[model samples]
Target: MLRVLLRTNALDDRVRKTLVDTLYTQPTNLAIGAITGVLCSLVAASYAPDRIFLELALLLTAIAAARIVMAVMLPRLRNRDARRMELLYEFGAFTYSAVLGVFAAMTVWYQLPATAQLLMVAYAIGYGTGIAARNAGRPSISIGQMILIFTPINVALWNGEDLAHRALAVAIVLLWIGMISITMTVFHTLRDSVAAAETSARLAEKMQHLARTDVVTGLHNRAGLNHYLVEYMSRRRAMPNLALFWLDLDKFKDINDALGHQVGDRVLSEVAQRLRAQAKQEAVIGRFGGDEFILACDVRDRREAETIALAVLADVTRPIRIDDDRLEIACSMGIALQPDDGEDLETLFQGADLALYHAKVNGRNQISFYDPSMSRNLVRRREIEAELRLALQRDELSIFFQPIVDLSTGRIRAFEALVRWFHPVKGELRPDEFIPVAEETGAIITLGNWITAQAARAAAQWPDDVTVAVNLSPLQIKAPGAAMGILNALREARLPAHRLELEITETVLLDHSKQTEDFMAELSAAGVRFALDDFGTGYSSLGYLNKYPFGKIKVDRSFVSGVNAGKKSDAIIRAVSGMASTLDMQIVAEGLETIEQVQAVQAAGCTLGQGYYFSRAVPDYLAGMLLARERERLDGPKRAIA
Candidate 1:
């Protein structure tokens, strides 16, 4: 019996309902046992003289009321997980059944009528059966209930001092033993069924957990993220102000390819841990697989979301170190604010994703928010990227020539070749729009080679003294066969290398790679002069001027545009001009939009000038006519002086 009570742990392992169901029939047994006790009390009271019925009725009433209370409370406890409370209900039922057995025993001890004794015997037998039915789920408790109901009655019958009573007790004891055996069988059967059901439920729950979890980071998986987003959106009808940030790890693939996946996996885990630490507890952060992670938080507006996005981006870029190698990671975040970006999760995420594309395109490791204008821009960019591919093959691309004049004489000494795209359907797209798309798609290589060929051909057709300047993208300078491409174009067009000048931006000088250095060296060695374009706007150091052999420096138009404002602009131009003179390099002052601007650059000792003040970039045929008129003007003066 103590063993069964100590098997509380076993009961804990069982389903809550198993124990609850075991007590389902308990209420009925309690009521039936109490009724039998009351009936026995009534029979005793009726037979007794005057006052005996009062005490008897009072005792029966107390027992019946207690039984009624327990019966009501026990049923309410069904499916309750509290095992001790369940055991107390079971004990109450056992005690009530035991009292009923004592009632039948009392009939033999009190010398009641022979018919009454037979009735009491029958009542005890019925109560015993009820015990078996009620306690089947608990074998040890059933044994205890059976003992309480049958033992006292059997002992009283045997102690009656008659052969007939003794024989009746023996026969009833045999039946009682068989009931106990059946109770044990039923108890084991019920317990086994409960265990099996509980095990199955637990297994299913574990499978669900595994499906929604990421093994590497223990964060929510992509499916889990989607599930969370669905739950969040469902509750966000009237108050749908949430920020969704999609972060992509910059240069993560390089680590995976260079250091093996193990190192990459470690890095990803670290990133996840750091992000979790930095995010608010209510925020939902999850891995969307690979190098991308998604974070979401409910906020009032874009400013709140932007703050979170910036914090997350900063968190993501923290350094991760393994062994001796420390990797500085960077993340670009695209933010979309709900109700502002979109009401639904799908539309919001799409906006965020497009913004992410712009972040990576504009220069990575930064955060950007979604704007309606971005959608239009993205559409146009997509159109340009698609058409630019076809434009290279279809020869739909053309060129415009802007003259670079000698600052002293205003002679058109050279023409800067600018590429223009005339889309068949979208009309003419500017270089800023299509060139970036082409560069992103690696179409710049083909486009660049074609530009070189075009420039060389045009320069070959011009006067031998006139030169053509072509701008080079950073990607072009980084490419391996860039010098070869330009050299071949010049050879094919029968143009002299001296007549073709390649202009490069400060970014090309800052590449720091041997590839960029070798490319510049190769082209310079082949007689193609280099001009530093947008020199002062970017990180133009004096060291670069001494290191790279540039034939000239084009002062960025931003400073040139501000020339008339104050001496500040003139001061910068003078400083740049002085540096160029010391290095024995020419200066081409760009963006000379006014005669005052031209005069400022000329006074500041600029060797060349080019802007709208001279003439806007014009078509090839018009450029040739302008060049002819300028040449005639310069020669007419030369002939008069001679």
Candidate 2:
């Protein structure tokens, strides 16, 4: 039956091996059967005192000794050929049964004393029953042994003339049939159990695979990567050095926003394919969620890792065609080497992520290796982020106002509110030192709202003609209740909506979501004004001016400082000023420090200017005093005429 199952492919190799292992598991049973047979043979020989009886006893003794020896050696030979071992066990069992059968048949054929014949018959029946129970897992061998033991004894009785002998043969035939039936039932039950266990194991393995794999890109997810790392690190001594690479797609959010999520998914899949193509045979690649991929490979040194990263960069940057769009993408990579960067998965991930952040901050579409300084910088940034949260609650935050001057009359038209942090331990901190941290930690929403209310209250105290402009963070603009928050601030301060100007950069327009549109429209309908700050530095589009309610444009400092430098800055400014004029929007030239820059911007048709040449940002009290002085200067000539 076992052979048939194997040849027909009905039983798995593992399951067959498991069944075979059960045959030798009961060494105690083997020892007991051998000793019982030898003792029975000796008793039978002593009673008969015949040549055949003595020879049978000797044969039984030799077989018993040989079986005992085989059982003792089975453990050492277990790792050798499985089929040969199984056959050897079956041969020993069958030969012992055949010898017992011959001993029983000889007693019956010779018409020996009833007591001796009954003793031999009883021993053979008991041994056959033991075989049926103990070796049921392999029914073919066990049942064959039972047949060999019973058939000869039954035949001997049938050939005798005595009616009692014939009756005994009939009863033995019935007993043998019952034992075979029981053996078959037990074998079927064991085989079914093995099959069920094998199926459950296969299902569990498949479920595990699905759990570790990414559904979208068919790559390993974070859990799978962790599993691989754990297994790899366990055998690190025998393997080459490991290099972990963290990769991020540049401006991927812009693609998702401009196109759709469907396109974004396709782009991610294509990127994963490219990564797979470039990866080495020993490399393990995974998606770290959202436009980010992680790769770990065996490398000899940093140079080998660098070579792989460069090849990946080259392949990934190639144009990918999806539908009618030919999208071009770029990725930045960071590498961390084993032992040098970290010894564990979490530390390696952190080091590689820090290096990736550094690459992105310096410039995108580049590669960077982990450095100890990057970790220090990360510690510092974390400290700043924590301190900033407390700074808000402790009232360490204050606002400063920079005056915007009207170029035609050289009079202050408005003031742009800037936030300043007065740290108790570090003195005053610049916005550049902490704003990015605030943005990342989501502290900007509260901080930006506070600035809005403070700026509105200060502007309410200024001359009615002067408007105060406050910059809006992208997060703040997208935040829920942002429009209501701004309106509440104005109402609390008794400031007119038109007297408060909101400044936004091109980043805010990237989403092109209805929420932003409604936020701007809600405030604009309430008589509030909007300005496009840092223009010409980002995704500057004339469509933004038409699509949004922006009434003013501030040229970026880079362009303003380059004015009259015999570069294209002059032409760019002139072009922007012309476009703003045609659209009836005000243009402010920022970062003006010299008369030459002011003159150049004025020549380029800028109506307003802001920078150190005009006045540095000052506190609310100083701004109020400047406004009072400017009011007096304007009225001085009017009083003389009256």
Please provide TM-scores, in order, for all candidate models, with all chains considered together.
0.69, 0.90
Supply candidate 1's per-residue lDDT for 379. 80
What's the lDDT for residue 346 in model 2?
89
Off by over 4 Å in 2: 1-10, 111-115, 236-240, 249-266, 317-319, 324-332, 360-366, 510-522, 538-549, 559-585, 594-605
TM-score of 2: 0.90
State the lDDT of candidate 2 residue by residue for 299-346, as single tens digits: 888888899999999999999999999988978988899979998888
**Steric overlap count per candidate:** 0, 0
Question: Ten-residue segment with the worst summed lDDT in candidate 1?
Answer: 48-57
RMSD of 1: 6.6
lDDT agreement of model 2 with the native: 0.88
* Best-fitting candidate, scored by lDDT: 2
lDDT of 2 at 215: 82
> What lDDT does candidate 1 reach at residue 186?
73
Q: What's the lDDT of the predicted structure labeled candidate 1?
A: 0.80
Quote the lDDT for 4 in model 1: 46
